[model samples]
Target: MVRTMNKCDETTVLNAIATCRFASASDAELLDAWTRDQLAEAFATLVNRYSVMVLSVCRRKCRCVSDAEDAYQTTFLLLAKNSAKIRHADRLAGWLHRVAQRSAVATLNRTAHMSEPDESLGEMVVIDNPLDEIAARHEAIILDEELAAMPERYRAVLVMQVYQGDPIETMAERFQTTVGTIRGRLQRGKKMLADRLRRRGVVPLIAISASMTTQVSSVEAASAASQLLGMLESSSIPPSPPLSESLLNPLLVNGRNLMSPWNLGCGAAIAGAIGVLLMGPAEGLVGASGGDTVDVVMAQKADADSEAAAVQFPAVKPADLSSVKTKQGSVAKVEKVDDPEVSELAIRLKGELDRVSDVSIDGTVESLADELQQQLGLPVLLDKRALAFAKLSPEQMLNFDSSQEPLRTSLRKLLDPLGMKATIENEGIVITANPSQLVHLGIGTDRWLSVDDETMRLFTEKLSESLKLQFIESPLRQVVSQLHESLGVNLMIDHRALDDIGVDDDFPVNYSLGGEVAAYDAIQMTLRSYDLELTVRNNVLLVTTMEGAEESLLSRIYWLEGLALDGNFDSLTQLIQTTIKPDQWEALGGRGTIGIGPGERPSIIVNQTYDIHRQIESLIDTLRSNSFHPQSKDTGAHKSTPARFGNPASGFGGGFGGGFGGAGGFMN
Candidate 1:
């Protein structure tokens, strides 16, 4: 067989495959074997023969040479894999071309990190009205030059689609991605091609026919230009064959029946062994799937996927396409706000944080707060609403920057009606409130935010990290001081105290918040006691001494669900004492509201899971107790608790509780 052959159109190649008689009866079978075995060499041949065409397509798809190269390599890889199944020699080129085209498109999809394949590539192309008479040959040359000028990635996609002839769906599946992703890529590729053409003087205007293409000068046209044009006319170049058949596997694998009897036997044996192992006594040692672990892992994976799957949107609206050529770039937009108060608050609050950008924090916080209210089944408090005290007003600002005594006095006056108290400290603040206060405020920590030894460890670590980012290593103290003045509070660190804790005040802290080792140690000392162990590394504290720690941690997280649901405080306090063994808590649950009681309202703790039935039961018990009952409720005089727990607006029973939704002072 000849190693090199004359250049021919894809159609001519297909005809040769259909007509030529091979010398051996097993030529088809041998070719099929060669498809997988010598795919590299076979692919190299295809590339050598069609490199120019491929380059042209890629040029049209990308904005630069590097991008085109990526697309080209990707397309060739696809061809190498798919070439084995092609049965007929005549149809191979056509098939291969199509696959190559799709591969280019897939490359764009992957690079752009899209979720869907674009279907708009076959749409009409528009050009300016004036360039029609430049001569067909000249137009082809111009188009070629323009395509080559584009980035490599763009050029590759164009080559794959327009020149290689691959379909959209094939490209999507080959890339192991979604159709939306492919479509997004194709859309980007088209816009780049259009832009390149325009820059090269081929303006794509409304007047130009979308179907315009390069044409060879006709004999009659040649004659018109020069009275002897007929003598100078030449035959037009024939169109190449379609690239579709040249690259498909002749033996298509049926997806539905992927496993043959032999494969099924192997799979069944493997499954059985896995099942047996899972059923063994060692299964108990395998442990329960930690819910918190799963949740955190899932959350992390979701974030990564979101980042990687961002698609570059086309300028064309999802609803309309004719107005713009393409999207310039992908970016977030800021919201328009007309209210001065809300705008001022947003600006002030956003400036006081880190890690999050200024433009986003304001929008996100308000949005999240609104969502939280809805999730908790409560109406949000607003300045214009009846819950005036809940809103931040002039009276609410009572010397927030002053010493603890004045601050505490002002907070007491503000929260007295709600039965709450505030404990002010230089470095910490704790809020104490009754169960009724929690019910009214619809805000409190629960299982999710519960202060377990581990949680305290995590929180302290996070705080330490935050402090480090803001103070220890940061030169932003001056800026921080200014912010404290604006917010009316002092945020300072004692260099000596930090040194005593084994952390250098000179350590630079990142602006992002997350407690460090010292923070965790402080937390252990101040909140969790010695129930948990803490170690610091790279400025991060790892607290991991609790026995059955994973299970305990999960429970703690589940308990937070109660907090998110707006559960009461004392009941939660009781639940913790009952659920966690004394040995586990280091005797922390023995005093005050720290222990559980049937009549108390639930405390919000992190990592606790309770069903609706338990939640209702808990609420009922609290309403029957004096903790949430109004002072007028004279036990026996109250007659009896209501059959069903009613809304806060309606009292639980005669004179038990008349109103709902009260303020809860901030936890120090």
Candidate 2:
């Protein structure tokens, strides 16, 4: 006999099912009633009958409670949207189960990188039958695999019928066919899906019954059904324009409303009044017109002068125009005002610095700069006196392999040989002879090399290549200085912060580098013991203390449960203390804390950088994995001690003891 359970009066439910003729009705009959007639009661009955099984499958496949709920909602929403396409009502349960699992897996994959567990959705009821749960989960997996392997059209039809709950008539309209054609497609789709599953050494079946009862609240099921129905109704309406694109288009600003005629008329009236006031009376216009014209001309010139003064070029130095002379022996006019065309050209060139090109420089700096200017569509300024002094020969060719390098890097390589540098200053890239002067001019220092994460990783890998080097407790400061000198890169250290951390500049560090050990590895090994690390910030090598580095790191909280600690809070607290170490925990200045309750589970709170937190999390996982199980025979004696308050051994229900209790106490 077909039976169903609801979280309402059993008698009432049976009576309602019998009165509605749903007691012996197949899934297809209910689906047809709901889809064709918009029967809300029929839809509610279907949701109540299947939500438990769908949620059970979702919880088994999902990693978190929120994901399970999300999958559950998505499964029903899909069904509601495509209620008309279901041909085989008997297979609806199996189809929904598979879809729920797929949705859950997708959600888990999307949130895999998120550290903190989601607590937004209500908790799922724990399943008691482990074997049954495993079987259901396995069946769902087989269905998912088979569904994935099906042809696109077959899968779409199957999803519409089973997952989306689309009526056959609606789907026929959607696919531009008759209801019989849609039904044929559904039958073929299900058969193909089953065949694929059988080929994979498994047979798909509706092992879990839709009639199986669950403790899931009827109110929740009814609510979900109502929402699904609303969604179905809303989906029939035409979609509005995208907010982002609509806002960007000036003519379509604020969705269909532009500058109204009223606004335009008001603006015109205001303009007319302002003109009348400015021109004075019309009777005196001829006499005062000439003076007014002169006044307007003077006003425009003053406004132009003010605008020019406001355009300040911080990178350009205030040098005499006579100092710069062209090859023709005449002083070149340097406009004090900012040139809009030159500014626009410079912006474009800066954006295209990563463009690949083949450049062959076979002449003097003057000729090379001129060629680059014409090729790149930007001005390339070179000091005339400096270029003349170098006196480059035509045969002194510099062929740049820019295919693998950016334009900026190639330009730097070309200029460095002449004891000069090419810097992107305001309106142009200026070639300066004095490297130090470039810094003062605010050109070189402001344009640090921008490296992506992948490039930096490769750089570190290269630096880690094995090198033979040895240092016997050498002062870290001296070692860093030597390494920086060898690498020809700037290394900065916070000497004051180091002193505060009790690390002197002359503090000794030991390292022995040989074989394939890279210089980068050696440096890291030396700093490892001193609680120091190397970080690249703003394109500069920074050597700082671990504590100092934590300032820039993100803070996260983690919850751990089912630790099987036998309610022994003292042992748990001691274990955590030993794992993290008292000195290290204290050094965090209350940023990290552990809380043990009078239960098996405990919580750990850590405030550190993401990298450091990952290390701590790994340690905790190891401890949890190695923890003694309460169910084991050897732990029977420990389990007998009833959980109570104020027990020193239990570490709860009374006064605080040692370890975490003495440090920060248990967190509720």
Candidate 3:
């Protein structure tokens, strides 16, 4: 069979997958355009959205280029014809993926006799014949289907994190679980998936899953072009194929499946050549289905910026927590706040601290810490970082005779000289640098190298890479274009936001770097001159005017349920407002806002910048950790705790204290 049509440059497809913004149009938006059939670029935009994924599958399933091309076209054609019939827009990837799988299968069955087996080509590994290829493809498809059929919480977490590239933390919030739980579920879920694969006489294709996920996850949501024109083009497309098979899910995966039957016999040939891909190389080993012993093998560095062998994100073991923790601190928005409110628990804790105890610090501060923890009946943990900042150490002498003084007063006298303050978190009393002092720790120090936008993992990867950039007083457009080209990332500027800063395309940007610096810092440095901040909205990064990211606000509720059990939330709100970014508060003539959440247990709600928000979370958590609590192991759950929180925020309750809407936002 003679190959027809052009093969989309595999490199372009890969690059597009990594940094291409599906024209910043939602699948629904893109489909709407494709259905309208007005603009000449509609088909192009729609094709670009899933082209990488479709072609990836086609490349594996088809024996020859011509067959793969036909199959790829047929897959999109089905989407084009049935664009209007798609009900679940969010799962468009999943739906299209399944469709592509089937289309490839169907296309192969139709042309099985046309081509005489296959040889080596493209990025795929060599296969001796089509039969072996079929078996491997069979495993991958079965794996996909079985994975789809598993419990959603597990399946969702796996796919979103591993497959689609959503961060585990994002998945936690989406699934409303803890970070630990998300990781735990991934292990359990992977085990279950592996078991099913093994039961089917196939070794788990987890390595393949990981590799694929890593690749797709690297794709950033922010895309290329004029914001309006890009949107318009994405929504407009060429005529679609006749609406035949829309979303055909025989096993029913992802959102209200519309079942459709196929007339052709199930193809005997699977993409057997993909056995190399499915089985991987002779040397690579991802962790077992169990969680532990996950290895962090550095991937072979890409030969160039465009090398396919370059796995920027390889399947690292969960044991490689340093990177994950780094991301948690930088890549992900770290809400360091766990509000320790003033309530019955707080009062009890205060009482404990305030109790006059026969205690004396005659030895090292470590001895005093031990006595305090035992005497106050609260866990004593030291914040080493805070201790360092305060210029104190556990070995240092904190000599004091508090035989008649309250623990609170005694502890205060010892720490005051060191610029240390004690706060009660749910866990125990924590000795750390005073909050007033720590605020200075984060002030004017936000690099934002990794925080926000999971879809931008690849973009974030680019942002973190060191580059020697030089631009001599270039126009903003020129600056944006050059950076986009260098970083290979789509840079979308919010013109309206620029207008807020009285800046425009012609705004002169002077950025010069003689040495290699992270692109993230570089971009921030470039935009900082014009008071611009980056934000992700509608799955696209927006170069907003210096309102934060200033204007971008993420709201989180601090559940001080245990501490707030019997106290007014007002004071807690005040503590947060006064301590963290005081000037940023709306009450203090800043854009930030904080308030009491009206719930059975008092909850504090605040809207702030990712930076300040992180501070607030830290502040709350610190307070809760040091705060004292009265507890009984046999005590039943508290009725005061709201049901949604499910677990107690502290010692007193089972769920939420309460929550409110209209959270605060940030201004850069």
Best by TM-score: 3
Off by over 4 Å in 2: 1-21, 84-98, 111-140, 147-668
- All models: lDDT? 0.31, 0.45, 0.47
> Which residue runs does candidate 1 get wrong by more than 4 Å?
1-36, 39-139, 164-166, 174-176, 205-212, 215-668
Give candidate 2's root-mean-square deviation (CA, Å). 30.5
| Candidate 1 lDDT tens digits, 1-668 | 75764333333343234323321222233334436465222323344444545444443444444454445554444444444444443233333334434434445554443334222221112335535433332444445544433333334445445544557665444433334434544554565556555655665331122213421123212212221111112213211212232332221332011122223344545444333322222110111321211000000012211211101112222343212111222222222224322232222211111111111111231242243234222222222222232322323322112122322233334444543433211112222333334334443323333334444344433444422223333532343343334333323433332332233323332233355344323333421221223322222223322221222232322112112212223333434333333112322211112322121122222332111212333443443332322211211111122322222212211111111111111211
Poorest 10 consecutive residues of model 3 by lDDT?
A: 659-668
Q: What is the descending TM-score order?
A: 3, 2, 1
Alpha-carbon TM-score of each model against the true structure: 0.19, 0.23, 0.28
lDDT of 2 by residue, 289-337 (tens): 2331100000001231121111112222336212333332433333233
Using lDDT as the measure, the top candidate is: 3
Please identify which of the two predictions, 1 or 2, would achieve the higher TM-score against the true structure: 2
Better of 2 and 3 by lDDT: 3
Model 2 per-residue lDDT at 207:
22
What are the per-model C-alpha RMSD values against the true structure? 30.8, 30.5, 25.0
